[model samples]
Target: MHPSAFLRLAALLALSLPAHAQEGMKQQPAASDRVKEVPSIEAVGLSGLKPGTILFTDHRDDPAKPENGLVPYLDWGRVRPAERAALAPYAGYAEPDYLQTLNGVSKRRHETLKVYVAQGRFVVPRPADSIDLASYATLGFVAKMDPVIKHKTLNPADVTPTKDPAAAFAKRPDRPWCDLGTVCIESRYDLEGKLPLGVKLANKLEDGASKKVAEFVSFQSELRTLPPAETAPLAGLTKIDAPVTGGLEQTIFWVNQILRFGKFLAVFQPMPGDPAKTVVTTYMALAIKADVLDRKQEYARVPVLKNLLPAQVLMGNSSFNTGTSISAGLPTYARNRMTAFADALAKN
Candidate 1:
């Protein structure tokens, strides 16, 4: 039997064994099972203009545990099988081909959206009474729609009085629909030893006159916390002040700085002749705080308190190959930063 086939057989045998017996069997640990299970939130009717039992857009009226407040909604109406073929050439180490293909196609044509929710203890402290909660949530992904183009043909015979048959034949009308694509959504968060609760919703939005609406939605499973081991890595990084813009630019800047001064080859390596490849992947950390000002006091006179909502980080890999490729180191670097930031946040 082929070595790969033998390995597969061995894996099957090991997995088929009783739980106790399998534990006794010795083998190299499988790649840490960090791959998370995407949840299905839409099937239970969690997405709509109004918030419902499963849906969460109406947080003001329908509040859930802070730790279970987020949801990911995915719309795949615009995704076609052909587009997947166009992406095969670009799929690899840090470049999981399927994910890269999905990302490439998603960049051009809208397909999926991943939302996140918080599932841990959080507090919004106030002067009189503090609001303590178990979860928090937000829309982590938004994709803008692309425009469509249409083509029209004009006839030369209509302009001239000439009765030439050739002119009439050459003036055939032709019209083609301009293909503008849809939107994409992706969310990232740390599993720092705490089982994070999350759900994904997928559906189609109604088509509008100027732009197509999002539709064909589906969501992932229900909220669940991460096991202790998974949450451990997130306990390291320091949480700094939220940046002015919550976009990926700030994270990119920080990763670039670490690459330049930190000199950590295991985390980052500069690609010669390519400026874009030097950026390491960094997770976007987000915190939501709520404050109620006193009417009797002036705006500046009121005290402000901080509340750490469900922290979310947008995890994306940067290509060192001039946008052509990605490396494994990007995620490794991102995880390290998340750990450090989480640690710092806990301290503060």
Candidate 2:
């Protein structure tokens, strides 16, 4: 299948499924499971919401309490059989192996969440297309060096338009794995013994004749190293031996992704309280993908089971259902992340 087609399918999976549907598809948890289930909110369906009005809600999971965090939302069983068949020949689709390693990050989880809006108005520093949205230092994640991966855009001279799907897919010169029309980021903390966690942000905005709509979606997942005792699952299966080499520090894998377009957009409007300043109200969807395990020994043994497994599961009970406090900080953190973006836009 064409890479673009794959992306389209991913987007479709992200948008079409409801929150309950997403939760239902996960590997069923045991009766003793205590993972907290949080409600999902929709920014677009809020009452009195107009076409351009931005509504925000920070539905988040606490990182400090890794145990209570949400599990992954996507699984192969949820996918249509035809769709799975089409992707079966791809690198990660057929079975669990090293080929699933796209770039440096593992493509193990296919989780997604809906976009929610947060309160505030932001100024678009420059044209959306011109801004370096993925500059980590500029966004306050990393300093000096640009940690965000950069991909070469398809040179018009290199691409040949064709009616044939196979020819078109093969000739497409654009970075096939890059998120085509969205801004995406993946970040892991530098320090060791720090939960092996990562934050993934992927968002998109659509412009209508008179108004523009934007969706901000994020996924937080755990990236744990497999324990020596967990070799039972790897017994018959071919383990991709392509592990990163180097010292302990060198062996640490960092998250990376190609950022496409910026999802941040601002519109001027007068409202109660702050009428003069540009209050950046962004639609943010902060999702903690549910990571659950039924029996003690299930570790994604098959393609279907792999979808049910997430790295967080390896952390044991600590990474299960979250408490109220974990989600309590979501609204503030969501606002803070977007605030940094707005501030950067102001300086730009």
Candidate 3:
């Protein structure tokens, strides 16, 4: 049976028992109380399941701590900004111009190169002076298990927080259900709610069927609805109508865009050939709309994410082939820029 379902059953069992009979037994909190604290659209209880029976635990409230009750190495605040920035550029934004120096070529050759070598490679030409806005949504996966926490053995200053950050994070730990290996899974929750967004992209890539790839690309195009909060503003922008081409390249683009504009969330790429594989890998991102340049107050409100320590389940060999998986940290320049933006916005 699905671990989530099992968890629900366990929770139900814990709840259904007589109060007097349960008095000697461990007292489980009421479901409503848990829900009020967690504030999730989805609800699940897994107290009845034996150790190791539960799959995913909801950890949205406390990313640093494990949902199943383990202490994690880091929390969301420590890692979110970096991950968002790493995922940002992949969304179909204009790549910055590269200044190349021709050591061996003459002035004439350099001029010639300029005519042919327009700034960056043209997978798609960015809209001139305008931002492309697409409707975006996100689905997060939560785990029920607690993470094993690791603290720095040495302290920079012989000081600790009067209050524990880990305890603060775990205060309201509820989220959409996930399995042991997958925690805090983020994806484009299709606005129409008809198709599985990110999973479909992974499946098409794995099948190696070009025709399906094209269809998947088309599906993404259809999924470009307006974000719930920013629909009117996004509708005013020019919509790019070109069909997204390329295999993984197109997939990466869509994923990146979602990260940037939708919710500033990052997603894990599946293995080269396995469709079922959905593990968060490297390449974090930071995406901000051009308009945010002017609206300091709105931009300042954007949250800073840091200290992203993914669960152990996210680590390990790819299910597809035992190839070396890719992981990346946010670029220094990108981090600096985002921090600057946030700082400027705050000041303004």
Instruction: Return the top candidate by lDDT.
Output: 2
Off by over 4 Å in 1: 1-9, 12-109, 119-348
What's the alpha carbon RMSD for model 1? 26.2
Report, for every candidate in turn, its global Cα lDDT versus the true structure. Answer: 0.19, 0.27, 0.21
Of the two candidates 1 and 3, the one with more favorable TM-score, higher being better, is: 1
* Models ranked on TM-score: 2, 1, 3
User: Model 1: number of clashes?
Assistant: 58
- The candidate, 1 or 3, that scores higher on lDDT is 3
Considering summed lDDT, which 10 consecutive residues are worst modelled in model 2? 245-254
Query: Which 10 successive residues of model 1 have the least lDDT summed?
Result: 197-206
Model 1 CA lDDT for position 122: 13
lDDT of 2 by residue, 1-348 (tens): 355644564455435444543343322233211111223322232233332233343233553332333222233325323222211222232211122344566554432322122333333323333443334222233211122212222323322222234223222243332123322233332211111111111111111213211121221111112233332232112111221111000010111211111122222222223233232233322222222223223323322222223323222222221222111133333344444545455665
Residue range 128-208, candidate 3, lDDT tens digits:
112122211111101111011111111212111112332121121232112121212322221211112212322332344
For 1-348, candidate 1 gives per-residue lDDT tens digits of 245544454444434444543232112122223221123212222111121111111111222232232222211113322211111111110111111124245332222222222111111111101111112111111110101111112132222112333222112133111111111112122222111111100001111223221211111111112233422332221121111111111111011101100111011112223322221112221111111111112211211101111111111111110110011122233333333322322333
**What are the models' TM-scores?**
0.18, 0.27, 0.16
lDDT of 3 at 283: 19
Ranking of all candidate structures by their lDDT, best first: 2, 3, 1
Taking all chains together, the TM-score of candidate 2 against the true structure is 0.27
